[model samples]
Target: MAIFNTRDRTIECRIVYYGPGRGGKTTNLEYIHRAFRKQTIGEMVSINTTGDRTLFFDFLPMGLGKIRGCEVKVQLYTVPGQIRYGSTRKLVLKGVDGVVFVADSLEVRRKENMLSLKDLQQNLAEQNKNIFKIPLVYQYNKRDLAEEGVPIMPVEVMERDLNSKLKIPSLPASAVNGKGVGATLKECLKLTLHHLQEELKWAVQDGL
Candidate 1:
């Protein structure tokens, strides 16, 4: 859900980057925090466990200027990707307005990718949000790892495994080097705002 602050004429929306452990969710947020300094309103807060994996979530609050009379603010978050952190992941997803699913391209993580996506759907269901209806995008990260002799799944195979049914927008990215990071965030933001616009129209129609 989006928080509309009437006093400030602003709407704050939550977008989460979700995926399997070590899939570059945190890297994406870190890159954004570094790359978009002017747009960022607050310092990014990241809590990492011993292995440097996100323990809770990485938060970056940013202002995206005004849209349709309301100042649009966005809170970007990355849920803890480790399987043992399932409860924390679910809690991070509460009131999420949009999501970017970061799928690891390593061949060894194929099953982990599928399982993480299923976990995402289950968590969203718990929050009463249909996974299909909500604004979602997929990021196939670590594509550059093939150069180092790392076995990686082909883009087509990843699509078949993760996006066969939903068929939403997907991007190939190496978040560590910042490739496709901005594009992924922009697409998610676009979809989220569009969804909110539709909801606003419906609310007005119902009131009328």
Candidate 2:
């Protein structure tokens, strides 16, 4: 659920980047912070936990215009993908409005990707949010590894393994190189804002 500030005329929402450990979630945030400097409102904060790091930053998207006369403020976050950080992952997802699952493209990580996704589904369910209904996007990261003679799954196979049932928007990306990063975030933002619009309408109608 997004926080609606009637007095400030602003609506703030959270979007989390989730996937297996070392799946390039942090890289995506770094690229966005570097490339979209004008839209970023604060320093990118990173919380280190043994083997993984959780990161977040606030972003004010431009050109999408206001929603119900309120400016949309987005808070982007990445959950630590290590399995030991289950509690932390759930905490990060507490009030998520959208999600970007950054699956690793390496063939060896196929199982890790599936497991992480299942963990996501369970975590969302715990919060009374359905994974299928939430605004979600799939990003198969590290496509560039293929060019380096590394074994990587084809996008079709990744979709079959991860998104065949959901059929949400999925993109092949090389986050470290900035490929598809902007597009992935853009698509997620579009879906999230659209979802929020309907929610806001209901709130108004219900006199909340």
Candidate 3:
């Protein structure tokens, strides 16, 4: 399981980005790293391969203020998007606080997006994770594909098919242009903080 150290009044939270290969997961990170390198705290590490890059990487965000006297830190990650790396994906997903699914908006990749989502669900389930219960977001990436860049499937269609039951935050994005990346990250951060606050409250009430 991915472990975090909550010591010396510091809190570390893990957030994972999951999607099919070539879904611009790496692009999202590169954009953020370039745009906010000054504001970010730690190094962003990447391991690339042929089919899918990023076996796993850390987008260590700068301290997002503080909570209950603990320094709050958000670390972002992307697993290898190749389906063959299923075992590695699960290994990285362990102890995740939030999830962002980067979906390809091209018509040809529609089914791949659906299948990737299902794979994510199954991987999380193996770790006793219920997506419905955890913080989740959907980023429909590569919105600049077509002349109009219209989604292959309508947003509503994607919602009904992949996100209706969850009702989580979802947005259209062109990761190449740095659009919607910050918005997606911010929403995930807010949700994760809310959940962590509840957990911390429970710990305090229990006198832990």
Best of the candidates, lDDT: 1
After TM-score superposition, the amount by which residue 96's alpha carbon in candidate 3 deviates from its true location, in angstroms, is: 0.6
- Candidate 3 lDDT over 19-106, as tens digits, reads 9988988898878888877657877778876654666554556656555565667778888888878888888888898898999888
lDDT of 3: 0.78
The count of backbone overlaps in candidate 3 is 0
Q: If both were scored by TM-score, which would come out higher, candidate 2 or candidate 3?
A: 2
Please give the lDDT score for candidate 1. 0.92
Better of 1 and 2 by lDDT: 1
* Candidate 2 lDDT over residue span 95-188, tens digit each: 9999999999999999999999999999999999999999999999999999999999999999999998999999999999999999999999
Off by over 4 Å in 1: 201-208
What TM-score, over all chains together, does every model reach?
Answer: 0.94, 0.89, 0.86
Q: What clash pairs does model 2 have?
A: none
Return the TM-score for candidate 2, rounded to 2 decimals: 0.89
Per-candidate RMSD vs. true structure? 3.1, 3.8, 3.5
Q: Give the CA lDDT, 0 to 100, for residue 181 in model 2.
A: 98
Question: Tens digits of per-residue lDDT for model 1 on 1-208?
Answer: 8987777777889999999999999999999999999999999999999989899999999998766667889999999999999999998999999999999999999999999999999999999999999999999999999999989999999999999999999999999999999999999988888887776431222211
Between candidates 1 and 3, the one scoring higher on TM-score is: 1
Please give the TM-score that candidate 1 achieves against the real structure. 0.94
Top candidate, metric TM-score: 1
